[model samples]
Target: MCTTKRGKIVGYCANELPCCDFTAKNTGSCGTVRVGSSSSPSAVFQSPDYPDFSSGDLNCNFQFDISNVSNKGYDGIQLNFEDAYMEGPGFARHSPCETDMIFIRGFKYWQPPAWCGNLTGYVAVIDKTKNTAFLKVVNILALMSGFRYKWRISVSLIKRSATSKNSETEMENMENELYPSPNINYADIQPQPEVRQSESRSNHRSRFHTKRHAPIFSDNSEDEEMDPIAEPFIVNGEDTNITDVPWQASIRTFYPDSFLKMASKTINNTDKFNQEKEGCSMEGRHFCGASIISNKHVLCAAHCFHGMTKLYGFKRLDHVKVFLGETDLCEDDLVKYGRKSQNYSIDKIIFHYGYDDIILMHDVVILKLKEKIKFNDYIKPIALSKRNKVYYGQQAKSSGWGLTNLTAKGASLPTILQSTGKMFVENKTYCDAFLEKGWAASKSLMASYPKYYNAYESVFCTSSKNDSISKLVGSGDSGGSIIVFDKTHDPPLPVQIGIVSYGLDGLESKREHDNVFVDFFQSVSFYRDWIDLAMSV
Candidate 1:
């Protein structure tokens, strides 16, 4: 009889199961193995009971630790798969692997592709910064009456030559020199706010605001003609000021006094009351971002308001406010900045008719303010990009008070506004390919957002070649502006081109490398007509 473990037999004991070695005692389960320069430079790992079909279900985990390899002058580690044969397709029908799968993790800088079903002769390289790598083999229904799976992989440390190391260092230094950091203190250089509106400003609501006009481009021009460019944006970002991005707007959702009172009466705990009060305040309520288009209109992501509706019911619009000319959200910081921030109640929010939350198609909203805004040096509206223009390959900038680091514990919203520099726009073709490659490794994303490909057409993608803090954007950055310089104007006008939309989640951001960090934005030019129609109302 075979010994049982975790609803499965512990390998084929004494040929009780077919295709098993009669002489073997226990031929399965290799839990964890530590490998480094101290022991060996290379090691081979195989599925439990190699060359034989193991009895019952299989759940094997193998971890490779090369923590000390870098200290010994090794620059990286390489995984060469000699043989890989597992259950192929047909099980789930939707996913590449359903009944049986192999998951690889623990690489810091590189994202390894999904591994399953005859990946023979495959090679994966991990940077020296990563200390460990994990491989997990899972077979859901590997029974005596079902099919079995097996694989074998060889891992070896890679030692760089002296010349190669020097060349790599020189290349890194050159890249850094090409894109110098902008370490300016934006708050120190902010222009003093004017005491009163000028006569010219009084006559016109805004310098950049245009009259209600018909669509500049016809519907046929909706198909974007893009030229691929190399660049990227945001989780690791720099501090910026409202003077730099005067059009930036903060969309906040606060709890009403009535709801707070009702909550205080319902819950008698003092700690809970204070917590709720603080959390429901204006500072805590900063949700999404927006960009000023006119004195009474701002552009934002529809999902921001959509999510609020789901949380606070249909009356969510009553609790929402738009803050302009603000850098820091803290009360003390606002006072220190001479109270430059202006808060306004929203009169109405118009979401795109084609807005689809599933694929995030037409994820845009036009927020009409109850009153006109008084423009000043610190607060101004930005010009919209022309419908015929596509700024592919040009550098772009994005600003928001979003989370600085996605991996940080709890909500990590920065007090001051964060901006990304040295980022470039990518074409739709490149964006689609990158999305497909990146999403292929994540099974959960594939399962949840199956129609993610539909987003490629209506969105603009941004990325950076060099690994910099500016390559990422976080949770609260939605609806912010992705501005690019339009040289067609005399002085190269700053035009609002894209609206910050969706991107990789926190877990996905961690696995992204330098060039692979990509963020999606809604193309402003694509929906220029819709924006004009909404603004006219």
Candidate 2:
């Protein structure tokens, strides 16, 4: 354990972990492993010889493994040049084909093989999100150019279904089968929805909701019928202030199934949400379900995100992949329909100061994008009622890639669509009517509508005729907008009147009044000033 003149280990390069030395790390030397005099170069050395056979034959199916891992061994990394996934790097096992008791080399994130050392840029992750946790390769050049090197990879995000120990048995006969089917690959799918003439567009359409439906929330006791004054805030129409509350961007995520009667949907009907047809992709991932307001600004729920600051030590735009207009989401289908999908990065997310939970301040957030998106048939923003006119029994579309009963286990990303439902706007006085169930009050589900409804400022409450069997909004779906159609306009316009706020639980969403939305806009309208100020700074 001799310290160097620099008071560090022999190979004390501060850049690498263990800080011993890349020389020592790569060397299978016993002296380096032990804390002996280790300073003598010759005595602390072992050869870094690797075999010609790697996990893959040649192509992108590049594979690798860690040597003697379960019993403690080496790690290796695979690199890729594109946005595709990595492959192999499975468990450490004895190589039957190779003699001399060869253990799997570099099973975890370790050294690359002696192949493909000339590749410039690449991504390194092995296996899918199912059997492995995808981690980004830290040092690309070092891993790719070093004595031990492997090929850079580009693969898909799809995972095979069978995860049992018998996976070898199940897959032995099926290893050649590509997952998600050749038909399921996003390669053929549309990144954006298709815009066709409402009639002709329905031709390729398989089956899904036509109209958007409100978050079907089940009544809860914690949701007390309260006065607007119960949750204090300033009132303004189009002119809203930024300092209306304090924690404007704090988002709260909920656990749907944890609570009873939270109106969290169970796998029952396959029609409203097709559990039988497709799978859930955006299941547990983070996405900011948002509403579009005037021009370029978008209003979304604050609790939908932690904001796009840090993701696994990388800076990612942690917002939803915005799709403007579309009937189908399959990128392939969009191409067939002649529809196009444009990509835009999120620039800014402005949450109102009044944002809070249980207690209302401002749950609404406004997003600024990197560029202004062009709107067309399948992609147009919903209209906002600067006034309190669009409400009650009036039908409109509400959509989001929200939770579906059982398909929660599937891989399809949540989506935005429209369904038909009624407006439940009533008098605040009506919320006081009590409905009781044994052990709890089952009375006046409609009461909270008017109870929290603010005629002058907030817009809340939408009801579907069949409350018994319908899809509803839950956790991650918050801050998403409710697209209200205004037939009164020339284009039969759709304007976003409500930003999905909160409810008793994750899946149970209660409508925040439209007046409340206006109030938030009124208070946050000062954001124009903030945006201009922030940009200048």
Candidate 3:
């Protein structure tokens, strides 16, 4: 220790007891690490002895400030943990949250959950909603064993003009202009279900329905009148008012055990050289989309349930959450957006028992929420079509947080719900041709599943009409609604005609005619009886 000129001791100040916990002190220059407004835009932080840290009551805090970059129009910071190995909760090793936990703060309105054990190389955290975040690490009672952890953060500070839609102010202005009030006059747009269809046009093949079974839904009581939608506001994929697609729902999956495994495998196989490579996609908490059919139930594609098996298995209802009246999943400050999001745990997953994952048939599932959803302008259920005929070409709408760009190999998700107009194509021949030739040639799974050899039955087709512009559902759009207008109703109610299923890749040049792509949707008409039965139970 150095001595002062006045003969007094000169040393760093140290707070006592709790303040000066084991890991709290700056041991080996591994104290509170700060990035962003610090010396660099990116940084690497680690425990005192990473890969071999000591034990017993370890605790420290790390902070990040990205306000400077955010003010410059940057999206936010991306934080990734490269390695984490510590003494886990003894008998409670199964609960990583209770061990030598790492706590996070300021990521959003709520406190970030604790993480412990070997979390390195498997964690990627992004702070897009706020400019700052706090991270704390704690280890308890393991002097014999040690701990290890490492982390890195990179910033995304893309510069954009004030007029760009990405601008915060621009988004606020658009939201206010589009929706002057929280609740639209839903009662005024009530549909007249008693209206009769024209006998002449009814005889001609209508482009609205082609299901074997008639429309099926619970009887409407006088107290509950189905609202009408005269015409859907069609546009290019962009953020819109939540009330625009009241039936739309965002599905999030949460399974800590499987998520950790996926993350670790991804990190172990990837390196800095190939980190940004396409197809090496990162999964978000919100994985798929659905559409509300009733206050307690929402409908989605059955295949969506199949894909989810890899994460939480086929029957993990607790791992699923349904978010209604949610337009933007990226929005961190929910209060700023006047969020009316209602999140509910799934009580049951009513999937088609005959659903063939390989053939992709009977691809429909109804999620029953533990609690019923309260109806509002932004949380209404879409009507199921009653017709059974479909015209060759008819206008419809597809909405979800799917891919915004068609050509990109791994497209980023749209921040807000993306809505685009599509046209139904009654071309069983075209669908069969692709399934027999195009799809069969590329996929090996077709050989094992004979039922998938052709698209002859139980499916409907849609495509982007404009050869130059694309507007079809992509990966994350699975289980979303394909709504069509029924003019037969008094006020023209928007009815769900189909649900998003498998589709020809929008990037496939062969499928494009003058640059247009085709997509397949599970006919909701055929699945109406299944839905009604499931909802009834």
Candidate 4:
């Protein structure tokens, strides 16, 4: 009987009892097969259902391991594909990339250039620097002749004495060009602090303040009307249905004092305000929100990783984790409710080269997970905006676990994920008007922050859709998504347009105060090319 668990084919074990022959052993599941060992330094790996891989749509992965080598000067490993047959999507150079191809990873590049067609007799030699390599073959369409119907590969370990000096030199050169050293000096990595603000500046108040008003107009006339299916939907209150925004992710980082504190346990607003005036002193443990873009990557604001360094402390990757598939942080028994969330450590972080802590421009950052995330209904990537040009008046939604009441003290933050819809302002000019004039902070504070001076440069602004009770993004909402429905796809998917960055406080940032300011976000469309580069690497 076929064995299926967590919506995947585990093996072909009979009676669903995990039999040996056709069944994969633990660590041997997930479309993966391990090969090679110290005892037998060489082995052959055949396509799934071997010699007959064409029987059905095929998607499989094979991994070569050489970690068992104990010798001090072990050379490396070599992989040779014999009679390789992979039917790519099309004959065109770029089109075939979308089809049935064998993808190789853990090497210098994302995919090997040699495995594009049904050719045979291709060979790859890996260096000893890396202990693992992967090969993924995907064939989605039905049978197509002359395409890849089947294939076989040989994997063998190589000792220093096994290969000639010339071969070793060639492999070393390739490694240098493809995968350079992955060593990163953690101590040397420091956040680029705000340019204008000195370390002595008061953290409680914005240094730059401005008081100017300008007439602004909407550019909706140039906006391409969105797809009909992309029309807005309505939801009441704060809690959102899990299915509503599957791309939302909780971006959490460890702190000495908890950023999230209970109302009864929180210090008085006076005490907290006094602490801020000294420096950016933060409570231990804080969480922002983010948006998933791929199985291995999520998009967030740069500040999530490096905000208020002196107050929050210099950040490190070890303190960060990304949580997916959960709506409530208070729920202790998630599996019982059919909700299984996964936590992934940060493997790498790429911030926009132009990111500025002072003006907060180019605030986007891409986080790479240590392992690829398994996609499901509760967790998915949101599409990037496809429109080459800008648009206004389209209703977008923002979701996070931010404060529900600006007036409350420590009891303000919500335990459950909350979401609300807002409308995009026409252009940067229109957005700047509100940012420059409506903030409760003084003009001097806005001036101290140069990022506030040029509001339209790299950010987009939005206001609440519901007129009765103004909805705005607040602290803890930073890095969350601003999404719009995309009717381009079959069922119309939500495409992310912006990343929440910061909010303007209403008059005072103290307790019992409201921040009556339009929310600003880093424009996703403006950095599409940058996002693509970050994801590929």
Candidate 5:
């Protein structure tokens, strides 16, 4: 229900990817909650659509409303017991993480803290009667640095038992009831692209249903490794099943032309980019980044440039160039395409005001073209989804020339325009079940997590998990945009979701059963007035 430092809400996901280090350090977007681990509050929550949870009785029974998810990372439950006990092997390794774990019958687990840490349990819905599970938090938290917390628990489910009242005992009882299934089955793990690429013709898009599958449950230490993307498993549960490797992302593209052809007007250029290096060409491999909230301004990630900000922060726009029309940036490839390159420069470089100088969230950059673009046949502006949303299953494409793997990771300028389909907003979930996985009522992140929830509130998200194939933004395309074509709109609308800020599986984005996008509309939605103020100024 919260945007983790990684799902965009935890985002996988190497989630909660930010524009720069500084942005990640402080408050992040509302749709994307960045909880720090320093035991400090940073991410804040404010939803006028909901009520103020101030006057509720402390002993009252609080039932949650979880919806729209069909996976572990999507819909489930958690509970955190502060100052709780951990008894078993490797508990220390998972220490600091207050949790609740259960071993299914026949599972040989030597641990018995009955608490939480590196614990694995299979999620189940009893007879679909409740269509939800239970969790509990029995430990009280101490006030540290003026932060005193009660036992906090959360569950991520499509819907909570609306008939039941929320109470401590009911919550605790529910947590205890969720038992691990000893011989968990993986015979039904869903496949990626869940639908075949061949079947996803634009007209047939959405023909692919929102996928559902069981999240893997393994005893290995690696299963819990936090990566934005995940891989499908084919294991024999009856025979010590093990799909417990780190989530490896491998996205394969098919029928990219359908996407390219849809982009009727592209920002083309007159100059040809002569690569000083071999791989950095924009030839059908380079990703496009835009800052065109207005004419004369272009936005991109800082990493797209070869030099780091410490070294190139002061570089002028003339040194930076942009390519629009050319699919192949390599000078040699031009002979085949019979085309030239359109180039622009970085007029000024101003990182996001709160960006981290070293890491992510600081990837945003601005460029200024020498002359105003003549929104002609090839060069034009893509309407930024700066505020509104373009729904699920739409085509979200990333255009750039960059390495798609971990080792060969490289950067490119004006590379080929590559596109992927977009995963839209999944329903808000109840992460209370996640509380059972921890032992504290307090929030977290690298130590300084924000305290914005006093009662139950849901975090909204955009799903983009591609379990069958790893389809994620790759290197050099860091600041590239995630655009989805709206078939429902007038004449097939093209809406923008913000820039492709970051992914979980390093160079290979961790795409799981389904992916989630940090709804840019949520963050910038309220700031429309602010943005207008800035634009007019």
Candidate 6:
């Protein structure tokens, strides 16, 4: 008989207590090892005789029940892997758990994959609602002498206050205090720009002109004297007020001087390279768009950072800059807006573990800012849509500072932010059909689309109802948000549903005349659990 204290097996009848009490009658076989409430809130568990080889074949199971703990309000369990060393994948590389592996359960949708080999720095969080969780370690190919495998995991209980649910509400309430009145007139509040009308029109004309059209104002005095106050031409979209889409963010990247020096040696055009170098040094170029999710965290496309790392040497945090609360990038908007527009440095970037560059799977990433943002009327975070909800055929809006014309030879960034008026969520079947046709016609797409294109549902498509060019997302809009209003709220709060991932124009074989203008966005609902987990950490 085993000794018991307060219904918890304290020790065996004769020997010292095991790491955990085995459920089976026999000493060590396949059975659950229950941890009593008397154990510390956080504890480290290790393989038998850790740091040394374990004799004979081994199979172990440990279970943790949060209900038995003193604190019933505990949110979840966090498993931090301090060390792990085991036999890796088989010769075929097909089965990662062919030899030795660790399996974790009770995380529901966020359950991590079976782990093997060196797994230092890995972390997994399991919700307490599941109550009971099991951690199993198995060694299938045990040697005659012994098995040389070891692992150390630190398990701790997490509090609900640290999770995204409360943090999101706190952030929203803090932002609401900054802007008491929602109907404030932005035009009356913002200062008028001091720029000359002619110069402003000239700037607009230069940037918006396409390769197919000659200069709107030529050397002729009559053309130059044309009414300067006339509305500046916009290709397909209209200018949007900063307050209307407060969550919009501009993700900029700067290349170091060392990188420019190396690039100069390879490029033949010294003049063009010199111009690019000047642009790289001053103000940093905007690479992608993002949406503010909280005071310190913003969401964007993972490809914006990963896709350019090789060519641009994006290894340092200092190279990235995030600008918020401003519509115009040309102005000293910080001084003009007075606390409304500010630039922030990134503290950390967390990408979805399953992100794939080739097929653009799970393309979203979260960025934590170095300083907490103070939200105002022109700067606020957008709420995320509920998980597993479908919003098919719903009308949504997208905003960005990307190029308005893709076919234009001398196209440049717009001075003001652009807004796609109303785009509808497209049918997945139709979008897939279009992609298949493109793949059949283009050899480049065929090479990348075969492995994961058909069954992938993590991305959704959007297109203009009238097929207007102005409503399409352009090159620099890769990380912007696809927002839909939740009518359930009294004021109909804007909820983010997607992150701009890629477009048909991203294809290598894309033609200027290609009428298909569908843009793909990383579905936010599908990854809501991952987002919550990331934010909690």
Point to the candidate with the largest TM-score.
6
State model 1's lDDT.
0.54
Worst 10 residues of 2 by lDDT: 198-207
Ranking by TM-score: 6, 3, 1, 4, 5, 2
Pick the lDDT winner: 6
Residue 148's lDDT in candidate 3: 33
* TM, every model: 0.49, 0.37, 0.50, 0.48, 0.38, 0.57
**Over 4 Å off, model 6:** 1-163, 166-235, 261-282, 307-310, 335-340, 408-410, 434-455, 467-470, 505-514
Residue 516 of model 2 has an lDDT of 14
lDDT of 5 by residue, 247-280 (tens): 0111111214654343222211211211224444
The 10-residue segment of model 5 with minimum total lDDT is 201-210
Q: Looking at model 4, which ten-residue stretch has the lowest summed lDDT?
A: 206-215
Report lDDT per candidate. 0.54, 0.28, 0.49, 0.50, 0.28, 0.56
* Model 2: lDDT of residue 342: 46
Model 3 C-alpha lDDT per residue in residues 1-537, reported as the tens digit of each score: 111121222234666322222432223233455555523555555565454544433456565555554445443333444454543443320123343555555432334334444433322223222213331211111211232333332222222233322322332333333322322233333221221111110000001100111111111212111111000112246566667787898887666876646654642233321222344232235556889876788888765554221222232465668888877665532564775578888776655534544445567777878898887767777777543555345667778876554332333455667887545554555555444443334334543444333234567766554545656666567788887765554344577888877553222343432333356677776655445555543
lDDT, model 4, position 424 = 46
- Clash totals in order: 11, 98, 10, 24, 125, 1
Cα lDDT of model 4 by residue, 1-537, tens digit: 332221224345667665332222112222667765667767776665456544224456666655565353444445555555554444321233334445445432332232434434334444332112222221111222232256776666545342223332442333234222222232432222211111111111111100000001211222122110110111133787455677788776553345424221432233421222233322223356888876788888875653232223224566678888777666632643577777788776665533445445567788878899887766777767642546475666788776554332432455567887644443555555544443434545754543343335457776553444666665567788887664443344566888887543222233223223356777887766456545544
Could you give the C-alpha RMSD of every candidate to the true structure, in order shown? Answer: 24.4, 23.7, 22.8, 24.2, 23.1, 16.0
lDDT of 4: 0.50
